[model samples]
Target: MATLRRYDLDWLRVIAILAVYLHHVGMPFNGDDFHIMNTDSSKLLDDMMVFFEQFRLPLLFLISGTGTIFAFSKRTWIQFTKERAVRLLVPLFFGVLIIVPPQTYFEHINEYASYFEVYKNADFGINHLWFIENLFWISLAVIPLILFLKSSKSNRLLCFFEQITAKKFGVFFGVLPLILILISSKKYFPSDSKDILNLSSTFYYGFFFVMGILFASAEGTWIHLKQFRKLNAVLFIISTIVFYAYYFMPSEWISPYLTINQRWNLWYIVCCLVGWTFVTTLLGYAQIWFNKKSVLVQKLNEAIYPFYILHQTVLIVLAYYIIQFELNIPLKMLLLLVTSFPIIILIYRFLVYPFKITRVLFGMKKRV
Candidate 1:
């Protein structure tokens, strides 16, 4: 179990969920212009949405890395696996079957597979649920890797990580992933669904995650930086600029493949480094500030897991119904978010609340 509580981790969870939500909800307006992703009725608004796009899931992945460290510390491997399975896999199964199928059915009408085929192949918008599915697999996949590292033979690699932590995190954890991301952008790794679904995405993300674990084990790599607040602030601004520049550039100019892979870019890589540092510093500040002030941030912290499991499904279901209402784009998204949030909340209260099995499977424990 966590010896000390961290509300910043909880806050990170909420923010990540919101990012995924807004990315799906607001991305249409962001002028991404990718045929499969475009839905925003406003060209200018879509362009502006690009400014915040880089910050979206990168922040989520950082939070996830933090959570991995937390989870690794708190449970036996079996317990951790069970907990992660419930949190990740169950939602994936339900989301693929009960939730995303209609959208797949609708979108692929020309090549429409049967509902059974779509369910089996997950040939739907369940594609967006990749984060949850991939993370579940990654959590399981890393168990053996962690076991090997815990063995005596991996001591040298472990010591190297420890030695690297002696320098600034911006040098070790921060710049390292960005360096890999930039290299990959130039040579480019495929970012297809199959890649994201298998070990590729996990290994890709695992490097960032291990950095987080090392940072966490060091336990205040960021807290020590408060003395350099002014320098950190300046770097934060520069990193933000780099992140957005890469996000907005046309796919053709950046990619030889001409697909919207959201593959790494120099600006993207630089910004992620700066962005992760800034966010980590802010998290450190939030941790210290909340400690001194005695603030509590647990309501939605408790609500968030279940909210994540059901929210996208609810949104898709709402969109399924709302699209029939003949609403405009803004009205459509509004109806989707509005309709989904409450209905999902109700499901948490009713359908998911009465049974212990349901609670464990969907993360819907009654608030204590």
Candidate 2:
């Protein structure tokens, strides 16, 4: 068979990264503790962020997992490992050393006198680049599993997945494992701090990564997703509404019936449903609508990784200054979004994309 290119996945990855960029831009105004905060916060933005937060990172990881199948198709295990390291680690190191410190400096501008001082004393942490760090390690961790799934030895496991996907409700069955994992681990890992060292987060994201591999490994999985796209979409919408309703309801309303632990468990189950449904829904729709190749998609596919790496740093630096102006939250957000996006693109176009060293450092494939 000729190599299958998933243009839908390309589009989804680009879109997901852009959503993350938007999320970051809205961060300072979302009433959340961030590198910088607007003097006033937006309840609307906070609620919207909370809703999107349910599925955004999980969707990205799932897409990454699916893309891994394609990546592994052409290369041997060792070559695949080396490529992942270069693509993930090089930018991670560069971000930690060169890009991330400025955000930290701005966060502690009163305590720190200069950017150089912050860089010198910068703790060895990944910060927002934690996603890259997690992906690198998850890629390495799953190598053996991917190899086995590709080999004949894994027929039983693949067959089970095949059977599952063939059923009427099989696509939704993907959420069961995630639910079980979250429910079981909730006591130990209460919240995802987005730290690479957080085992809970690692496991949480790793589950989606592995799910992607399994979805790709079993033939007919995408067909099943497309077939049930409508149902998944409905579930996603319902779950999202239910999630926000439950999230915003007064605690006293629930305090009469459920204990705190029980309430949290219920919330986790809802979150799992919401996250998985949204992911499958998008996958299904992408298969139907976005599978066709496009020049724009190809260009974005090339540029998005570098864009992801460079985005948070640029946003934080800009927001650090933008939030200081005597402006309302909306105006500040508009300024940050409008200004930061083009700056990132220009930096990528003029500086990162044109040079081999910058491309490699930003995790783009070097030009031929």
Candidate 3:
């Protein structure tokens, strides 16, 4: 079978990364204790953040898994592993050593007079690059499995999955395994985002990564997704309403807090359902309508990885200053959004794109 080139996946990747940027910028405005904060905060922003938390990273991990299948198509398994290490780890190390300290400095500057102080006392932690750290390990963990899939012995198993993807509604099975993972994570690890070692998210994100692999490797998935697009959209809308209602509406009958020890809760179940539906609906729509290409899409796609690596640091620094102006929430968010993009773009274009060493450090391809 011929490998498909998915421009839609590229588009979604760009959108997801931008959404992360927006999410982080919204963090301080929403009263989350991020590296920086605007003086103005909003309950409305908090609600939006909760909704975004349900799906954003999951979508990216799924996309990463699909991209992995395509990437391996062009290289040997060992080659792929090395590439993932360089692509993921190099940027992670660079971010830890260079990019992240500014955020931490701003975060602790009143306590510590210098960036060097923050650097010395701080653990050289991955910070936002925790995503990269988790991804690197997850990629390594999946290699043996991918190697097994590559062998002729796995042909029958592959065929079995392919057959399922060919069925009209069978793609829904992808969400079932994820539910188990989410439940396990919620019960044990409980998703402390600040804890880089949180096994909960590792297992949770790894599930979506596997889902992407299945989607890419299975036959007829694209057709099935398109065929079920309308249903997926309806399900997405319904799930969104249910999620928001349960999440935002306060009533004596309903409690939003979920505990894994309880065996199951409506919040956990709805989150899994909504997460999968949002992904399905987005993927189906993108594949159907966004497969066509544009120059801007190509540029954004190339810029995305580096932008993700650099965006938060830039945002935190800019937000530190922007918040000092005492602007309302909308204008602060708008100003940060408008200002940060160009600065990030300029840095990527001038500093990252032109140099061979910087390219590798930032997870870009070496200059050809």
Candidate 4:
């Protein structure tokens, strides 16, 4: 039942890291999703994108929150804050100013935007590194509350949340308003770095990270998820399909209400609930099925952080070439994915493993 047990975290990290890699590079054979659409069946890949999209950020939030509970419990507030800032904030700053700008510069230079313009533009820094910024910002924003809350009775907040989530009806009603809010402000809700001005993501989605830290205190929950293995497996598959079906239908056709209203508030909540539950539950089951002691899980868990930071840059490089060559979307995607794996491994071997950048960038330790 140990939450941070090597295997469980390893499995989740592998799932997250690979899912993210796929998100950027896309499925190996998916070509229609390229900037230039074609008559290929790669529409299915786009469908897959919608289905898997819900869980990537959310699962990451849960994993981080779960780890934070363990981490914060062992350290003083100052220690925890310093650790988080060092790990996330420092990297975010560097990513914006140094590590990320070259690629940003390269990608947008042809678009007639000035360097000054790019610097001034809020979204210009580290296009895909938004997660690191948000993670740091959310952690910093929530620490005071976390310190205050954690100082009180250990189980008081948890019991309160348990009381809320314990009820089937409460889950529906509690998430319904957030859904409405997201739908109302769909253009805003953490869609990009610019959305920081929109308070909903800060208050709603950011709060989920807080809940992740709080609720994940119970590594025992994995056991509960495991207990429901057979049932959850069926539900996960069905929900994944339902999630994809939404993407296949044009938004105009499926929900004129959403398009006219221009909000993801309703569907976001509904999908998030189903998505969060199934993804974590399935991961828990995977922890069991993959037997946690496997070598592959261990290596992947170690590589994921660097993989995350480095993959997008690699993906963009490949994306440009694929488009330039006018290759079939599926074939190009396949070639790009094949090319990316060796490049990612090589980068990790040099910049991270030998250079030992984890201490400076990702707040992680060596294991692989």
Which candidate ranks first by lDDT, i.e. highest?
A: 2
Q: What is the C-alpha lDDT of each candidate?
A: 0.60, 0.87, 0.82, 0.62
Root-mean-square deviation of every model: 5.1, 1.4, 2.3, 4.7
- The segments of candidate 4 whose C-alpha lies over 4 angstroms from its true place after superposition are 1-6, 27-42, 109-124, 160-194, 202-204, 234-259, 262-266, 294-296, 356-368
RMSD of 2: 1.4
Model 1 steric clash pairs: 28-40, 29-46, 30-46, 31-46
TM-scores for every candidate against the unseen true structure = 0.74, 0.97, 0.93, 0.77
Tens-digit lDDT track of model 3 for 102-192 = 8888876798867788766864667799889888888888887777776787788888886786676666657777788777677778865
Each model's total of backbone clashes: 4, 0, 0, 7
lDDT per residue for candidate 4 within 125-165, as digits (tens), equals: 55667777677777767677667656646567656665655
For model 2 the local lDDT of residue 123 reads 51
Rank by lDDT (best first): 2, 3, 4, 1
lDDT computed for candidate 3: 0.82
Q: Which candidate gets the maximum TM-score versus the true structure?
A: 2
Ranking by TM-score: 2, 3, 4, 1
Candidate 3 at 305: error in angstroms?
0.8
Q: List the residue pairs that clash in candidate 3.
A: none
Q: lDDT winner between 1 and 2, please give it.
A: 2
Instruction: Name the TM-score of candidate 2.
Output: 0.97
